[model samples]
Target: MWSLFALLLGLVVGSFLNVVIHRIPRKESIAFPPSRCPHCGHPLGPLDLVPVLSYLLLKGRCRYCARPISPRYPLVEALTGGLFLLASRFYPPGVEAFLVFAFLAFLVALSFLDLDTFELPD
Candidate 1:
């Protein structure tokens, strides 16, 4: 169904948003260098990057470093997925729902960035 598709899409986008939230304020390129374990700077492989499920399966620690990962990662992914499902119900399966998803995603990024840095990026 459209709701399921939207939720999955949101989860994937939320994963990318993690990179955005981490690199944007630091003026780092979001596209290059790929995702890594922050504690060890080891490039993360596919199994290490499965949104909320990976965090749960790994028990919230980096596999490479055994350091605690922030719970915010899964929280954001779930929130985005929830928002996408909600938007799909409200706006139907069309461009409007897609726009709503984009807006909601932008807001989520802004919110976490503000919390993490005490300032919002331009």
Candidate 2:
């Protein structure tokens, strides 16, 4: 059950990480504009934003404009979920696990940023 909880939390965090990856490089505020379809600029609603599930349900296309969505979104969510599950299994319940999670989050963020900008931010 704890592993499942961690996986869910990872998925949610991965969703936020997508926002961070897209907005941070562009100097945009992550909190102001909600997640939207990049190709169409459509403001995504709840159903359109459910991590990996939404991508699958929409057939990897935007609900509003039928634009092909990037597969990276679901890939990041799955990767984060798997990492969280792995961390839960390896680290005992304490500060160690928390530190592992924090490290993983930074690595993931840096990875996406690299993919976006072709360079890591200094």
Candidate 3:
């Protein structure tokens, strides 16, 4: 189903969003250093990082450090997945999706940065 495909796509994008959310605030390079746990500095294994399912299974805690995880992880995943489904419903395909996705990503980053740092760098 197209909806299923969109959801899977969203999940992947949401995973990248997690990376962006973590890195952008710290002024770290999003590409390098790889994904790791913020509280424990443990390199997160695949099993520990499966979008919404991982957060649910782990009860929103780091497996390595048992630190309470932020609810933002699942929130981002759900938000992206829902947005994908909604966009697919409203728009056919092509540039509509790309444009909306780009804007959504920017808004997400801006919202988080404003909430956490109270300032927007970019």
Candidate 4:
């Protein structure tokens, strides 16, 4: 049950990470504008925002414009979920595991930023 909780929490956090990865590089506010389709600039609806399930259900295309969605979103969510599950399984319930997860999330966000700008954000 704890592992399941961790996985769900990780997925939620991964979704937020996606927002950060995209907005941080562009110097945009992550919270002001809700998530939108990059290709069409269509604001995503609630149904379009489910972690991995929405991607699969939408056939990896934007519902508004039918543009192909990037696979990275679901991939990151799954990866984070897997990592959280692993952390729960391997580490005793405490701050250490939480720190590890936080560090991993930071690394993941940093990697995404690096990929986008080819430079690390300071």
Candidate 5:
């Protein structure tokens, strides 16, 4: 069940990554104003907020307004999931795993933001 645990961990991290992605651009506090749709400002229900499956089920559109969702959601979730698998295989639990996980997360976020905004902030 380690894989399942890893997947669950990845999902939680993916949720935080979504917050980071949304806030980093807007210069807002990630902790403030719980997750909401930018287009309609509706707080996401739990079902509407599942990491990758929700996006797929909704066909990548906000349920409240039907606005097209960005592909970044699944991409980040998949990316983190893959990294978790690879990390578990390559490194036992220790500092290396933590470092690698952190690096992988930062890289994913940086690459995605650069691709979307075409500018580097950090």
Candidate 6:
């Protein structure tokens, strides 16, 4: 049960990390602007932002613009979820586990960002 919760939590965090990976390089406010279709700039609603499920249901296309969404979104989400599930199975919940989770998430964001920009953010 706790592992399932960890997976769900990681999925949600990975979705936000997607935003971070895209926005940090551009120096955009990650929080001020909600998730939007990059092509049409349509704001995403709750259903449009349900982590991997939304991407699959949308058929890898933007709901508003019909542009092909990057496969990376679901990939990151699933990766994070899987990582969290694996960690939960191995580590007892506590500060150390929290640090591990945070470090894993930071690594995920940094890796994707570095792939795009080739420069690490401070």
Model 1 Cα lDDT, one tens digit per residue, 10-52 = 8988988899999999999999998998888999999999989
Give the per-residue Cα lDDT of candidate 6 at 110: 88
Between candidates 5 and 6, name the one with more favorable TM-score. 6
lDDT of each residue in 58-92, candidate 3, tens digit only:
99999999999999988888888787777777666
List model 2 lDDT by residue over 23-79, tens digit each: 999999999888878988889999999989999999999999998999998988888
Query: Which candidate order results from sorting by lDDT in descending order?
Result: 6, 1, 4, 2, 5, 3
Candidate 6 local lDDT, 1-122, one digit each (tens): 87988899899989999999989999999997898999999999999999999999999999888999999999999999888888998888788877888999999998999899888766
Task: State each model's CA lDDT, in order.
Answer: 0.91, 0.87, 0.81, 0.89, 0.81, 0.91
> Would you list the clashing residue pairs of candidate 1?
none
Compute each candidate's TM-score over C-alphas. 0.94, 0.92, 0.87, 0.92, 0.85, 0.95
Candidate 6's C-alpha lDDT?
Answer: 0.91
Flag clash pairs in model 6. Answer: none
For model 4, how many clashes?
0
In model 3, the Cα lDDT at residue 8 comes to 72
Cα error, residue 122 of model 1, in Å, equals: 13
Off by over 4 Å in 2: none
Which has the higher TM-score value, candidate number 1 or candidate number 3? Answer: 1
Better of 1 and 5 by lDDT: 1
Model 5 vs. true fold: TM: 0.85
Q: Would you give me the overall lDDT of model 1?
A: 0.91
lDDT of 4 at 95: 91
The C-alpha stretches of model 1 lying farther than 4 A from their native spots are none
RMSD over all Cα atoms, model 1: 1.7
